[model samples]
Target: MDLRALTLLAGANSSGKSSVMQPLLLLKQTLHEDRYDPGPLKLDGPNVVFTDAGQFISQVAVGQRPRFEVSLGVGKDRGRLLYEPSAAGVTLSETGVSVGQAPEIIMRDGSVVSARETAVLLELPGLEAEGKNSIASRHGIAHEIPLVPWVSIAVVDGVLLKGSVEFPAVGWKTHLSNDLMRLIHLGGHRGNPSRRYPRSVSSSDLRPGVFHEQAAGVIAHWKQHDPASLDALQSAMRTVGLGWSIEPVDLDATAIDLRIGRTRETSRAARDLVSIADVGFGVSQSLPVLVALIDAKPGQLVYIEQPEIHLHPRAQVGVADLIVEASRRGARVVIETHSEIILTRIQYHVAKGTLPPKDVLVHWFACDPKTGDTTVTAVEPDAAGAFGDWPVDFAEVGERVDREYIEAAWKRQSGEAG
Candidate 1:
């Protein structure tokens, strides 16, 4: 329904997940520049053919002697191409086709026009006339604007379609590279990367001065939306079943120290201080990402990999609820996940009317090692509360473990009889 938001392209590892994402990114590039040679095409191999002549001609503009036009369709929008007559030969970027200088063309609007946008239009090869261009004979024309590029982060250990963003004019597909850059550029954003939390202030928390501005943005977000009342935060923590009481504290201009209760007496009033690493893997991994999601503005698509890793069953369920909260608040979330606990929790919330089922759908990816292919199925529940097509190979490792246990039980029964 909200097509731009959360959509999962689920398939097991090496099952063409990245293959799908790459082409979409290349299509986005085509919107700005006209059709390019297959050699330069980022998505497919050089020999791959994308479009034919009929498709090419339709994209051309038929107007004044030298003007050109391009027409195509993507999703719900029909792309209109228009080019103008110029002293220097006019070039249509879509098809990489160019006509002599100063040829006038009639626009789709029935108005005579000229310029680069038109060049972009005429170059689109929806249907091209024969002998259209040198490249057309070698490589067919390509139409279609790349809306948003796809980015995959790990949902557990495999790829998940976190979210997609439309290109500028359209917009850039900024989900993966941009966000990763933000974190990387923050420079010295070390928060106990050693996977060990210190009892007191340590060297890991000491970041360089260069991170001041970026750290400021991070701290501001916590102060703005995190609960003001320590009690409220504690209650929220309890609801998620985490035993710790967390309070936000300003560390410096760019950092907020999260204090958790330590002792029984002071624990009532004093929040426990934690080395980010000392916490459970789930808390450290999910918290920073959740913080990022809350900080994002509406219309931003947040692509997150498996948010369930290392989390307990209850925490997995809580993360599902958190995702619902983010979606309701207008941040679109596209997540890749494998935890059945997370899946069950989402269904439970939907059934209880905590979240609308229509707004969310679970896609299951089952990999078949025999064929070396992965099959994708929608995992929506029916009235019977069972997934429609539960592939036998959904979790190969689990299946193996179950088989071993059954065999062991059979052996024990035979031994007892003897």
Candidate 2:
């Protein structure tokens, strides 16, 4: 995904949307939990949890292993892995790591090969890696065993993992790790309002979790340490039509709560009047999303599920405004939404010439009932706010509903007349 592009992922239920995102999330979860090196893949963690690799494998491709590929920075860095599903966890069969710095993997013996060919060369004796998170082993020629045991190579730091390549890296690091580490996720029980939140458990913590359990703390961090960022946060909140400015109140040293009140322009008093819990449920649900988007720095990826949840139809337009504005501000946004109003507003931006059509993409996913496979149809808005394909599933559903309703009404009217 382009760092500045606004991409929307939408589709029928269980049409493999989550499956596409889970691999990156798995990488994030694995790095987050340091208990094990987790050679190639992590089966369970906070973002996504699973007991067995078979749970992640495709049912149709029964004989094949559960494999995944990752490319970030527009394929500047990429990796591919094939793992054997096990009862306890998955084991990697072959792995490949490559980066864009030199466009080639430099070997210890001065033989340079294209990074793209690493996967095909995994079984053969070749160059190994050196340095921290690096591995070098020649099975027969060097009489060495595989360093990572399950996998051939794993690269976390592209530059740092560089040594003389004889074998691949041995650690759970990757060039994409930094991007994934900085990603912002807004989800879970954030819609559930509470009167107060804990100040913080860790001062250095950044991720707010799916429920945004760390949201209030992050807000307060900006308020105290980075007032300029807090201003941006407040500005973004106002843009979302929340009207009330955000203020963090300290109940004590250990507890904190957020308050929202109209600004001087909207109210006579600039003082915050009510806690976040006192607002409408829609406001509470939208708060975390706006926070996540606003908090995202330039080039930071923000993934939000159903951002328009619990919002009134009209208010969803504000969500569109936020999405467009975030992309313009250089924050990469990936929104998985089912709201027509939200999508329409974004389309309107393209139609109005306010946003470039090339910068906006809508991907519609559909599932084949018989085969259980998924396909993606992508489109970008034109000057008329028209995408080449139906951007949301509800459009067809609404038409079918209208047709069914009219048919039933006609049958009932004929019977009455007879």
Candidate 3:
């Protein structure tokens, strides 16, 4: 749930790892200019496609009208909005809004105060003023807002049942733009390699393409203007054991050939470059991931799904190095994966003090098949890099497979002896 650094989303097949990530993508697609006037939420888009609202709202949940909240936070400050499915998209209103200009609103001992003259009580929309104490707990903490000229003094009695600010709070917008808006998603299949990938110019400096269609052009961009960055990307490919260094050759004014060459074991033949299509699927699927991680600026978010897919076990472990490298470079890395090889290699780095355990987060998700409710648990690792709270289900299948193999081998040996 901490999207600031290295986070691993691991769980059962239907346990909602991707579900937690969807909201971020939902926000990304909404901001994407490619989709004409994508509303507050684009239900079906390139980042994540959905035909109906039912895919989002669960029937098993017992709420009269279930809604999902997309929360934004930076450091200790936070803002959240709740939305329900509306037609092909979603609908949301300004729930509770509080604006404080003096600085930050401080909350302590069930009393809220500000050193400055003004404190805006978050007024929840549509709720009539009634009980004060009972309604307080549902509200978000006193959030810091941008300096605005207009404000009136107000107070609510209850614990603040999820209030929304009226102006949408410029501070939250800036924070979102810095984090989720700048996020690069290398999820799902990155597409098959080709002889020439059409070049694309990115629309905004803040937002990269959610589908990552600009990766080839980005490589080409770096080659012409930022050779140092391109070198870093090539270094990353080696770190991931992909070993094939990338060369961007402009085919014409509108296209480029992303050639791959082997330079890991330097030789005369290593200098020869071939079309990316000549390499197998593994390199193609992972090229975007390396590109995102290496090219991301500090404080940007980069999310990848199954970073180890279509790779040998050794190469999978090398991906751990790349993830750690990207994180160390000040880019946040969020990965949804089932690759135990990559996970264990991360642990190895932590144990060797190459990475701090505090910098890494592992979330284990499990869903109740009958109820369809999902629960997430943080699997914490000790200083020794041992996950003491590792779930039984996580290890169960592996142990069972090992036991079955041993038993089968013993039976075969006994039959041969007889």
Which candidate number has the best lDDT? Answer: 3
Q: Which candidate is the best by TM-score?
A: 3
Provide the lDDT at 397 for model 1: 62
Better of 2 and 3 by lDDT: 3
- Compose the digit string of candidate 3's lDDT tens values, residues 322-386: 88888988888899999887788888888999888888889989889888788888876778888
lDDT of each: 0.41, 0.64, 0.67
Ranking by lDDT: 3, 2, 1
- Ranking of candidates on TM-score, top first: 3, 2, 1
Give the runs in model 1 whose Cα sits over 4 Å from its true position: 1-6, 17-220, 224-236, 241-243, 248-251, 254-256, 262-271, 292-298, 366-387, 390-407, 413-418
Tell me which of candidates 2 and 3 scores higher on TM-score: 3
lDDT score, candidate 2, position 228: 82
Give residue 275's error in model 1 in angstroms.
Answer: 2.6
RMSD of each: 14.5, 6.3, 8.4
lDDT of 2 by residue, 238-274 (tens): 6666655888889998888888876646555455457
Report, for all candidates in order, the number of backbone clashes: 45, 11, 17
